[model samples]
Target: MLELLLIACLASPVGMVIEEPPKHEAAKVEHPKPEKKRPSVAVPEEPPTAKEKAAPVPKSTPKPKPAPPAIDTKRLAEAEARAKRLTSENAKLQEALARKELPTGGEIRNPAEALAELREGNRRFVEGHRIRSLLASQDPDLRQTLTKGQAPFAVIVTCSDSRLMDNYIFDQELGRLFTIREAGNCPDTQGVASVEYAVEHLGSKVVVVLGHTACGAIKAVAEANGKPLPGNLWSFQAAMSGLLETTHEDPNETAAEHLRHLERNNAVRQAQVVLDRSEIVRHLVSIGKVKVLPAVYDLATGQVLFLELPKPAKAGESAHH
Candidate 1:
């Protein structure tokens, strides 16, 4: 009976279902569904407030520009024309000056040439080659020609000594030198006026204050020693007021030497006096239109020594000294 029971247990019952245990099936691999995209819609901005709309927008300020300079065409043209004319005249003058030739009729227009002519004439006179002036005096037509008009080139302020003849000393003919004579060669007011006339009207280019060696007038003044001279000659002391102070007598030098010094100083002083008293002379000298020089003439040698001129005074200076 036990054997039959075992065999029946081993045998499968007919129409019995045998179901397998539920497998894990990889957790069913659950894939998530794709997310759907929604259509986009733009949101409108908020409208400006009434106060902001009514307010004005600030603008940048532009810088102001300067105006252009005005041009005067007529004045510009006149200036250009004047410059050209002056340039042309200057070129012509330079050409004339370079040649060193005297113009027609042996006339000198400028101061340098006038001074040179005087020097050459003096040289001729000293060297005994003075021939032109001799013939000039003899010429009949020369005097008549001079009568028409005179254009003296030099004005001579010289002593009235009998031996000191400026025409013979410089070998200049008539109308060539306008001469003024005083006892001491010191120019007074009238003498200065004569110089003004010569320079301004006659166009004389050189004014020479000429002194000389062995001058009697200088000796008289020196010997007088501030004492009033006898007769009308006392005016000479007044004219030569500061001469003694300017030229102190040297103990080592002879009395004659001191007189010579006084003579030369007087010449220089007179030249300065002319410049101080006469504005016309000062202006011409300053502009180079004329020259005022002091010269010493040797009575024995007949030679002229031109002294160095003093420097011009500054403007507004009342006196030259």
Candidate 2:
């Protein structure tokens, strides 16, 4: 029993020590992902050969480009409206200026307006043009126009003395005044007719009988027509005796005084002749249609002693008229 026990113990130990074989593993597939690589080569930037360069494109007539869209109707309408408004506004402004009653250097349309303008200008000249700057330019257009026609604004009937020049006395422009120069500024029949034309046709408003100092014409009348005044003036001496006789009687008066008295008297006489001789001028004067001013222009003072008259007032009121 002991021997059997020993054998059984050995056998049981041997059986307990026995182990199952390990499972076999799959075969290693060490393909290394086939190394998954292609041959690495550098590429050239150029074509493979110069002869293989791209061929030039053939020249062609290009298709017409698409047109831009038509302009908007609203934009066109707005532009037209703006243009019309501007044009209407311009016309309105022109109309307003036309109707305005201002002396815009236009023609003096009436006798009364002409007189008023002369008086107004004289007033401004006597005072000063301190009001505002004048906008009038010396028109070059006048230069071209005056070359074509004679438009004398005034007619000066004055003495034929060296001391009296019409442009100097009145500060007038060339062709601005028509002058009929004579001794004593007296009206013969010729002078009478000339004055009528100046007033009636040339639109001359005034017949300026401008007289001056140291008159030879009056001296011939004063010295009793004895010394023989120069140049076809003796006939006038007979006509002017009444005026000259007044000067001679004043013995107290100086030679200068004699001349001044003569100057004034001659202007007065001529003014009378204008009314007596020219019926048209006389009618024009009487109706307040035109003015006839008898003026004695002083050589020393450059001032005019004027008589505004319906002229030919008698010698009795010579100082007043």
Candidate 3:
């Protein structure tokens, strides 16, 4: 019975030891995840047109320049011509007034005629009708004429006062009047030599010792009253002191009258002094070759008053005998 049971157990797999199946842990399966898709953008299919590609550019315009101002050429030319014509007419008028006959040689050749001419010029000046031509010693033609030789008709020894302009006072131009001036119209040796030159060399016939009112030199001498004057002024005072002493003062005369008397006396004395000191002038006067006159200029009236007029000699007396 046991053997039969073992055979049955072995055949029935119950009696043998059962073995456990192998336990292998299942391996985890790996798989790739699906990729995320981006959304698609739509693209335009058209190209750019020719008008859009070729754009026009704007042009700038330039500003115009301003016009120049007009000139009155015609009017300007007419004015210039008128001025020229007026100048010509004025020059002609001057020539007509100065026209005079000139005589041949000698000291003054004709003293009376020269005196008359001077008187006429003075009259013109007094009347305020001075001829322009007589004043134009600067004219080229007149200057040319004078350059030939100077023949002044008068020798004026007058005070060196600015108010006493020899040319304007006499209305005489260049080459017409020879003048000598000192502070008091007093002549020294040098002055005498100049006068001699004018008479002996220049043939001047008339010598006028001219004085004026309010002579400063005369006043100074009077005020000094024989006291010594300062510097070179002493010479002038000394020369004038003798005249002051010789001048007779009137008791009833006003101060102005006294001053006027002194002025007149001073002029007369100066004229005598010229005669006394200059042998040449004395000889000329004695021979009737020249004349010396004493005159006073009035500052207020622009008039010259003759204190004494020298008598004109006979026609033949003018020539040196």
Give each model's whole-structure lDDT. 0.72, 0.55, 0.65
| Ranking 2 against 3 by lDDT, winner | 3
TM-score of 3: 0.62
Q: Write the per-residue lDDT of candidate 2 for residues 180-290, one digit (tens) a residue.
A: 888878867888888888777766666777777667777667765355666776676755746754544478888777677777766876777677667898788767656
Q: For residues 51-72, could you state the per-residue lDDT of candidate 1 as single tens digits?
A: 4455575665654544544656
Q: Which ranges of candidate 3 are over 4 A from the true structure?
A: 1-108, 132-134, 309-321
TM-score of each: 0.65, 0.53, 0.62
Alpha-carbon lDDT of model 2: 0.55
Instruction: Order the candidates by lDDT, highest first.
Output: 1, 3, 2
Regions more than 4 Å wrong, model 1 = 1-106, 136-138, 316-321
lDDT minimum window of 10 residues, candidate 2: 129-138
Q: lDDT per residue, candidate 3, 5-41, as tens digits?
A: 2222222111131132112211111233333233233
